[model samples]
Target chain A: MKKLDNTLIIGIGNNTRQDDGLGWCFLDALVKNGFNEEKLLYKYQLMVEDTDLIAKYKTVFFVDANKTALNEGFLIEKLTPSKKVSFSTHAVPPNQILNLCETIYHKKPTAYLIKIEGYEWDFKIELSKKASENLKNAIKAFIKEF
Target chain B: MNPRKIIIEPVTRVEGHGKVTIKLDENGKVSDAYLHIVEFRGFEKFIQGHPYWEAPVLVQRLCGICPVSHHLAAAKAIDQLVGIDPENLSPTATKLRRLLHYGQVFQSHALHFFYLASPDLLFGINAPAEKRNIVAVASENMELAKKGILMRKFGQEIIKALAGKKIHGILAVPGGVHKTFTKEERAYFLDGIKIPNIDTMIDWSKEIIDFMKNYHLENAQWIDNFAAYPSNHLSLVDKETGALELYNGRLRSVDFEGNELLNIEDIEYRYHFKEAVKPWSYLKFPYMTKYGSANGWNRVGPLARLNTCKYITTPLAEIERRIFKSTTQNKPNNMTMHTHWARLIEMLHCAELMKELLLDNELMATTDLVRKGTPRTKGIGIIEAPRGTLIHEYHTDDKGLITKCNLIVSTTHNNEAMNRGVRVVANEILSEKPEITEPMLNQIEIAIRAYDPCLSCATHALGEMPLIVQLKDYQGNLIDEKIR
Candidate 1:
């Protein structure tokens, strides 16, 4: 019933792992850019808990890392409610989270999954060289679009 | 009859990477079954050189699902390193940490029982793999799925409000915590975040319990002898009050008969509990000293905590526990499948506890948030992780640089029991004809899923977990596979 009109941008990834934190890097960029209209959230992974917040939003973007094979740099894909949600407490796909918002919360916030490419996701915090460059390109694109 | 093998690799629904392998003998009878944990995170070996205070924050990165557990356990261990007495935790700091733990437990348990475990319990273990998930639940029963998501959001909101983030919030420190609970936070919980949904938040848990109770016969059997094995149980219990303690308490071990085996000091977990590694798994097997490795292994998590505690400190959960225990005739209930119910009850306890903690007037004490003290070289912090008992031990130098660190996570504690459960289910459910139906394969996983092991989903990426059940020939070649 109440709308925040705030486009909820959730950056999801393991920040401690190299390149995996690329999504977090985007959230950092969003904050540093001083773009205040949208609510910025950082989560390690998407969960069932996120749907309520997503329900209040007018639109949502889930920024995450993709293995190189999935996307070489970054790909923004439209999301549909996924009927298949695996039995897990920690992980739910962004589409499924959107589905929960539409199904449970009675609100359908237009949703998109922004997949960033990553080379090394080892137990390190800093992004690898290729991932860093890709992040920069993705940031430039985000700035232009937003 | 040629012996056939059914392998459920990269099992979906649980955390981290683990698989189930069921072997059928020449007579087509169940010969051997094993649940294997394939990944190895050498946190113990790698966290050695970091500063002692960094242990809590560093280990939180281990699991996105239960970072709060690792965070609190590491903080408590570091608290010991800084010489905070178990009996003398700063009142304000203790209460704040308890509130934080409540949020963690609430969110985690809500997520597990409703979203993960209930998918099978409600849908049936024999249900088609493609049709047995929350999406199906949402489509068929939108109300239940809605309640589950919102309830989970409530728990997560509390976590985000206190810890500053949902996944890994660095709020705790050695002597005490980093922040205090402010009015803004209370208002956030009471009005701001949960304004319109308070009624749903409070009422839905009761309805869920009542709904689940409707299927007593079938669900009880689901949790009965097959997956629920009798073994020693371990959890944190108040030394004096004998109540179930999640945040801080003395370690207690009980037999399957609910007899107290040992009342161990938290500092003595290393001396009493021993972990042994097998060649097959990266996870270690933990067993009590008295029973020895061959038999001393015990179950933890909701079932263990529920069975071992004398009384719960909270309200609604306490009532639920009474009914639960009465079902077992007030003795130690060993049914592993009932862990789902126990988790739900604990979650309700957390909600009630949060209501009490948030409304109380005198909960904040920024003055005592951090204590100034000389650091000790070694400290062991223990807490009942939502899954089970989480022990974080760090050895440091006088300068507080970590020399060695050993972590005993929740799932590893149940490793032996999970493997044993697979065998029990295979023995009972698997036929001599090696039928290997989807339900039979599902039953094998049902045994392991009761544990809700954190081993698989620990890495926690956006990677899709397609439910795949693979049937392999004994020669290690894939015979057939079904991806749901």
Candidate 2:
């Protein structure tokens, strides 16, 4: 894997929730591909403290499972801070973290979101076959694009 | 004149999914109201087959906001299962656990005030929905928002250092904590070099309390009276001195006017408490069995803690607590909105407690982290979580597998109190009104939010809960629906 300095990759989702594990699985794939383990973070959800974390990095990539269908099994798009705000300590959206970072720390890291389509959200840990395929495509596209 | 019901589904700015239903009589007068928890997670049943040693880690899956509370509570119970009571634990181990618990409470209270409840307080309930959020709070008051973020971070950092991660991190094992605090970890919080130090946290906590006091003074009419009602209050108080105790203590309950109802050993909770289920919601109403279902229910959170404890041990918080009590002439403050004030005082108390622990050299002990004695088949652990009193009880068979598990989470205890609050607000704001407006709906939510109810633990689910309101006729036909 190519070495990327000063870049933080945050994989946000719960691995116990079947396809919701896509984000963490993506991070696992990166580690398997020889990416620096320190650069990757696995999170069940984003929180206010994440703003402090992203401030030190020059770039950040948020990867999570998307419930909605995307044309490509996966999509990677540049991200902008969300003006709309909603909060539940159980989970906070990635874009909102970026917005908080810009608001508090006055630093806007170059950010992008890699959303992999998912299915079968249940209590089980195993991803559905279709979601697994989408995760593979997402990892492949993510590595090439970055 | 047709009777109607107004439903507010998925209250905004709360932890999990809950809905409010206000039933109006044919005369357009409020007849009944309820706060319903929708999702259900059978954690108690799922935890039955797990080993006794795994209880601490397994229970954390119940909540993200207060996982540390769950983790510590389960750890205490696991400690008893291994035959070590709280008093028998090594002093170093005990202080380390206390520090971790205080850190958990500190961060959680900061999150609740700065992120969740601050919006409703900063911008009045009548303010537009878009403006009632942390982002909007940040846009308007950047320094305040930054302080909120840093204050929360300080607490998370403490968790990370003691445990391994911020959420669901492992700290305690069966008999005692798995690890000990180090000088570097202690310095990180005390030295104030990297992040704001303990002193700074204490200072900022004081500043917030002042802000709350001033806010109360300006909005006294609403702050003291909104959704206010008299009921029983419950929490853990210091076993010996009767001072405010969060980590471990004897159970205490007092009525609305400051009458002692029950004060007993924490482990003997089952003998006094009973849970009653309602068909309308997944959450159960917990009350003292003696008082019966209707009158037995008690509110168990910051407001309850202040109401039950004789005095705060910390000097600064004691001062603030006195001022808070004076508002009601030192009687139990039944004001629902004053919960935010009590929560801030607790945050300050936690800050003072953290400083005392960090400065103490006992945290440096590396040995004697675990201890055990004669084993027990059943163990109960209760602690003051940020939201309220959290109880975890487990029974294991000879094979060491859990045979039964019961959890009376903080939100569960306050279920009835929240319903009463909703009814109070609905009656005040919506009774006799022909139309249901957004502000009207928000006022009902404000009542529930005052308790800082963690519906995730109440109903136990993980998902997004968007705000939706539906109006129905008395016969249960949907007349109108609106989603935000």
Candidate 3:
């Protein structure tokens, strides 16, 4: 945020959960396409303390894979701070993390949830071919928007 | 009048999903209350047919919160496959594993205390939910929050340096580790412990303990007395000197009065323990062998460890340990809520242990990192995780592929206690009212949180849970319901 812009592109998911790794793959494709920036980071999952890290950015694009999102390609939705607060560390959503950012940091960054359709969630590391193709299209569409 | 039931599903503030069920009798007095922990667990059965050596790294996938514990425990169990004499671990290999373990415990303890449990104690459980999270923690005390983040990161740095990655590290192998502690890494941590101005991880942990014991928890303990009940405690201790032993030790069980009940070998755990499966939950209930099911259910984890140990070895943690052992200065600290204090003491001990290992001359030795030997069938490994004693038992064939495996994690060990805690809290709080309140339910969850149950090990339930909770009359008809 301090470098070129206040925007952050973060990919969040487990890399080993087949298409769940779409977040990492999407970021990797962005990097390969020469759309690299210091603001881009990848996390295994959204965490409770991530609010502090998110507060620094003025805008954020959170990329993840959703099995139930639109099957066409990808869906992008604007995010607002939600009042949800989790006592458990495992089930926190990105919007709630932003809500925490708003509550604690007193700054509300513009954020969006970028969800790519995924079919498989097996125990291996490689992405399925269909998932790979969808990732490509999703990245192509997302970059165009950016 | 029909009976009513109140249920809280996915008991928040822990590592995984759980549920608490409270049944009200016709008179509106609390009749039954128990906690059910759920998770997806088949790795033990699924790991069969894989090479014995693969168990160490494979089981690490079970819980992201405690991968290092699994990694080391599996590695140690496989060590027996090669038949390295117990006390004869190659000096170099032993030193490296111990350092890696200390790093694991330090980071994990820091994460649980600063991230998970602190909010409840720092801000009251009844505090506004938005103000009771890490964000608020960061806002209120910027330095403490920042220190927690950095110190937790420092522990992960050690893990990355040794295991290659912070989470699913593929470092520990049977008999030893793959890498040696390099001098450069040691210097980096040594500096991390003390730099910028004059600050150290040890001192930070001490300050946390002091603050918690003296002010934060001291004022709040009155509200969380459900955590202060008596129960049997279990932990691993040095067989000779009876000190708190993390990486390896004999299993010890003590009563509420701190008198030893029994000390057994890890290999003999199967004979001394029994696991029962309740029809309602995915998690199994584990109890001791001699006492039978009625009297055998006991508790493990930080509180148990502190209660079972004769003394802590590190000077800073030892000072805290004496205070923790008996808040009254003469009895075992039975308050489950005080596990937060016990965790900080352990973190302090781990930091001191990490410094001692980092400065040791033999830590950087490149040779003897692994031992070469033939594999044998049936190997057992036991180690103390950040939570409690973790047991990994494997039986293999002549071909070295696993045929059977079983794991008894700390959460499973404390399942009964968690349920009992929920019941105890409900009994203490509930009255003739037919309806239950949200704060009352949250207090029940606080009971389960006291153990920090790791449901990843217990979860084998398929698909996502609809998390439906129903209230029924004594005849079991759906009279009321809540879905979450």
Chain B TM-score (each prediction, in order): 0.95, 0.99, 0.93
Q: Please state the Cα-based DockQ of model 3 relative to the true two-chain complex.
A: 0.30
Docking class of 3: acceptable
Q: CA shift at B314, candidate 1, in angstroms?
A: 1.9
| lDDT, candidate 3, A8-116, per-residue tens | 8889888889999999898888877776567788888776556667777889989999888585768889998887554455446888888767766687989999898
Clashing residue pairs for model 1: A87-B13, B15-B456, B15-B457, B16-B455, B16-B456, B16-B457, B16-B458, B17-B456, B28-B432, B228-B336
| Model 1 spans > 4 angstroms off | A1-6, A10-34, A42-44, A62-79, A84-91, A112-146, B192-202, B217-219, B456-464, B467-484
**Candidate 1 CAPRI assessment class:** medium
DockQ per candidate: 0.56, 0.67, 0.30
In model 3 chain B, the worst 10-residue window by lDDT is: B460-469
Better of 1 and 2 by DockQ: 2
Q: Could you say which candidate leads in lDDT?
A: 2
* Model 2 TM-score relative to the real fold: 0.94
lDDT of 1 by residue, B1-484 (tens): 6677777777777767787888876687878888888886677878888888888888888887788988988888888788786555777888888888988888787777677777687788778887777777777788788778777777777777778888778788888877888877777677744443444555677777777667666555555666767888889998888788888888888888988887888889888888887877778898887779997888889989988899998777788899989988999988777777787778777777788888776576567677746557888889998889988888998777899888888898988889999988888888575356777777777787778788932322222456577766667677788765
Off by over 4 Å in 2: A1-5, A15-22, A25-36, A66-74, A116-146
- Assess every candidate by TM-score: 0.89, 0.94, 0.87
